[model samples]
Target: MIGFVILAIIALGGGIGVIVARQPVHSALFLIMNILALAIFYILLSAEFLAAAQVIVYAGAIMVLFLFVVTLLTAGKDDREPKENLAGQRLTAGILAVLVGGGLAVVGVLYPSRAIGLGLPHNFGNLRGMGVTLWGPDFIYLAAVALMLLTAAVGVLVLNRPRRQVKPAPRLEERES
Candidate 1:
């Protein structure tokens, strides 16, 4: 219980840090920390496969890709872009935030407290169970997700590829000079 509490606090802190970080790289690192904490939670819940997947797919691949994108975009320095001046933007944002928060609070107040039940069978989190699910009717969805990721990675590579600048042949007079 204490460990869970500690992990939850760390996760929450990481989430907040991700939002509050000024640098994109710092935010990505904080996001990685959050992903790791979630993986730990999965392990604590006896979902070892999910824990491993979370670490490998999210913390490892996705975070690395995000950091690469951040570095590529910023070139390791803050690009001080001018802030946009939209009139009443902050006021509008504050109004939306208050509305969302108030709605959530109202829902919480109305919701009844009950002992939540685990909805899975005993072998739910095991490797075999995951395999059955992944290879079963859901295989097409998984394949589609994998394809999408591959496409995005390819897109990033294409975007970052150096273009071959075709320099016009020097004028004959300039060559002579």
Candidate 2:
């Protein structure tokens, strides 16, 4: 229970850091921290396969992909853009964040009685059990996620590809000369 609470705090803090980070790379690092905390939570829940998947898939692959996208977009430049002078944007953002936090606190206080408990089988944490569960009913959702990732990767590649430069035709005088 203590471990769960610690991991939950880490996850929550990392999530907030991800949103609060200014640089994209910093945001990705924060997201990785959140993923690691989630993996730890999975371990605490006796979901070993989920823990491994969370670390391997989300922390490893997805974060790497995000970093790559950020790097490509930034082209290794650290030039920070000038902040927008939108009046009250910061105040509005702060108010919205407080509202969201208060709403979540309210939900946390109120939703416990409505929560349902499900019993897990003995082999639920094993890879074979996870495979069966995933490949059985949730295969379509898995495939959709894969397809979405592939599409995003392709889109990034397309956006980052160098365009062909069409040379202008020489002027008549230059051609004659």
**TM-scores of the candidates in the order shown:** 0.64, 0.69
Off by over 4 Å in 2: 22-25, 62-78, 113-115, 164-177
* Predictions in order: lDDT: 0.86, 0.87
- Could you tell me which residue pairs clash in candidate 2? none
Residue lDDT tens for model 1, 76-139: 5755656876978867986997799789868966894463363667577889988898899799
Evaluated against the true structure, the overall lDDT of model 2 is 0.87
lDDT of 2 by residue, 74-131 (tens): 7768767677868899889989999999899789867864333766775889899878
The Cα error of candidate 2 at residue 45, in Å, is: 2.5
* Per-structure clash totals for the candidates: 0, 0
> By summed lDDT, which 10 consecutive residues of candidate 1 come out lowest?
112-121
